[model samples]
Target: MRIDFSNWKPLTIREVNNIFSRISIYWGVAGGCALDMHLGRKTREHSDTDIVIFREDQQMVYQLLKNEWTLYKAKDGKLSLWLEGEYLDAVSDIWISRDNQSPWAFQIMLMDCEQGNWIYRREKTIKVSKEELFSTEENNVPYLKPAIQLLYKGGSSQIREKDFSDFQSVLPSLSLKEKEWLKEALKRQFPLGHSWMKSLED
Candidate 1:
C-alpha cells in the first residue's frame, strides 16, 4: 500500500489527539500541515506527517511507524530515515533545535504513498491545550513554543510566502517577550525588520 495522503484515512484533528493520548514518544505536529491542524483550515493533502524524532530512541520510533512505511536513509546496516510514508517529496531530513538557534539535521525514514504537486509552505498556528503541546512518547521531539516558531520562521528569508503570511497571521497572539525575541532573532538574521521594518521596531 502506497503511503498516500489522497488515500490516507482522514484523521480528524481530534483523532490525532486521542491516538497519542498515552504513547511514550516525543512527537509533534510539524511542517505546514501542523499549521493547518491548529487553524482548522484545509491543509494541502500531506503524503506523510512530519515528526521530530529525537536523536535518541530512534530505533523505537521506527518500530512504531514501520507498518507499511518506507525508509529514506540507511547507515551501517541501520536505517536513519524521515517519514512514516514512502514518498520522496513527502520524506525530508528532520531538524530539531532549541533557542531558535541550533537545529540538528538528521535523516529519517519516509514512506511515499503518492506523487504530490505542491510542496507545503508554512503558516497558521493555533494555540492548542497544554496536553496537545507536550509529547508523552519516549522520543525527544521538542515542542516549538510560539515564540520560537515565529522566530525561526521569520529568520528564514527563503521561507515560502505562505509561511511568512502564517507568521503574520499568528503575530497577534505572540506574547510581548516573544515579539521582542522575534525582533532580535530576525534583526540578527535580516538586518532588523527589513521586510516589515516598522513592525520589528514597534
Candidate 2:
C-alpha cells in the first residue's frame, strides 16, 4: 500500500512525554528532534518524530498503545497491521496513528540491548552502557545522546543533505568527549573511513 507521507503530524516532545509517562519502560526521543533537544533549540523542519524503545520492551509498549492506537509495521517498503503481542524480532520501524484514517502520530524505532549495554543494531561490536545511551536534559526530556544520534546518521548507507546539515549544526556544540566517542565509533563502523571523522578530529 502506498503511504501518504504528508499524513504525518508528529507530536511535540512534550506531547510524547505526556503519553509515555504512563509506561515504566525506557523510551527516548530520537532522530533530528533528538539532536535539536541536545542543542536546546530547533535546527530545522522535521516531518516526523521518532521515539526509541529497546526491542525487549516492545510487548510492554505494545500493550500500552494497543487499545487506543493503530500500529502498522513498516518493512520492505510496505505496511501491515501489527498483531497483538506479536514479537517484532526483525522489524525495526513501526508507524502509529490514532486510527486507520487518522494522520500518523509518530514512529517507533526499536533498538537492541544486552547485559545493560546498548548495542548498535548495525554493528554488534559497537556498544555503550545503557546509562550513557540517553540523556535527560534540564526540561526532563529524555533523548538519545547527540553523539549516538550522529553515529546513526553518519552510518546511513545513503546519507542525506539534512544529515550533513545536522552534523554541521551540532558539531560546534559537541563536547570533546562526545566528538571523541563519535569519531571512534565511526572508525569502528566504517574502517575504510568516514567524511565526518576529519571534522571530529579537528
Candidate 3:
C-alpha cells in the first residue's frame, strides 16, 4: 500500500527502536538502512525503512500494531487492508501507518522459515540458520549481514545503481568467510553471466 509521498520522511534509527524494540518477534533492519547499521553510521538519505520479519511472527506484529496502525497487504503492486488474524502466505509485505491521514511509518517484508532455518524466498533450496541471518551491533540493534544483504541486492537479474554503491561501501570490511559465502550463493542463483559475479570474484 502506498501513501502520501509528498511529505514523506523516513523513520530515524531511534524511531525504529521505539516502535519495534518492545515487540516480541525475530526481526531486523533490512535494505539500505541495514547497510548503514552494519557500517555503524548513516551513509545516505533513505526513501523508506525496510524491516524483515518471519511469517510465523507476523501475528505478533499485527497484535502489537493493530490498535494504533493500519495494516495493508502489499503484493504484486496491489494493496489491500490486512484483516485481523488473517495470515496469507502469499502476502510478503505489510505496510503500516497510524491511519489514512498519516504517512506510512515503515514496511515489514515477511519471510519464510522452517525449523529455525531461513528459507530464501526466491529459492527454497537455499537456506541459512537464524544465527547467520543477522548480526548485532554494540548498541544491540540487529541487522541483516552485509554480505547477505548484498546477495539479495545482486541476486536479481539486473542490479540497481544503489545496490552497486552499497556493495562498494561494504566490500572492504567483508570477512573472507562472508565473501566466499556470497560468491557461492551468486554462483547458485545466477549460474552464468551474472554481472556481480565478476566483482565478487575479484
User: Which candidate leads the pack in lDDT?
Assistant: 2
On residues 78-183, what C-alpha lDDT tens digit does candidate 3 reach at each position? Answer: 7678999798799998777778667778888998999899988776788899877988888788888898889889886678899889998888788888988988
Residue 29 lDDT (model 1): 50
Q: Give per-residue CA lDDT, model 1, range 58-149, as digits (tens).
A: 55655553563344443334334445533333233532211122222222322211122111122122123334333222233333354445
Give per-residue lDDT, candidate 3, residue 7.
38
Name the 10 consecutive residues with the lowest summed lDDT in model 3. 1-10
How far is 202's C-alpha from truth in model 3 (Å)? 1.6
- Poorly placed runs, candidate 2 (over 4 Å): none
Q: Rank the candidates by lDDT, best first.
A: 2, 3, 1
At residue 122, what lDDT does model 1 achieve?
Answer: 28
What TM-score does model 2 achieve against the real structure? 0.97
| Per-model TM-score versus the true fold | 0.51, 0.97, 0.93
> Lowest-scoring 10 consecutive residues by lDDT in candidate 2?
1-10
lDDT of each: 0.44, 0.91, 0.82
lDDT of 3 at 143: 86
Which stretches in model 3 have alpha-carbon errors above 4 Å? 1-7
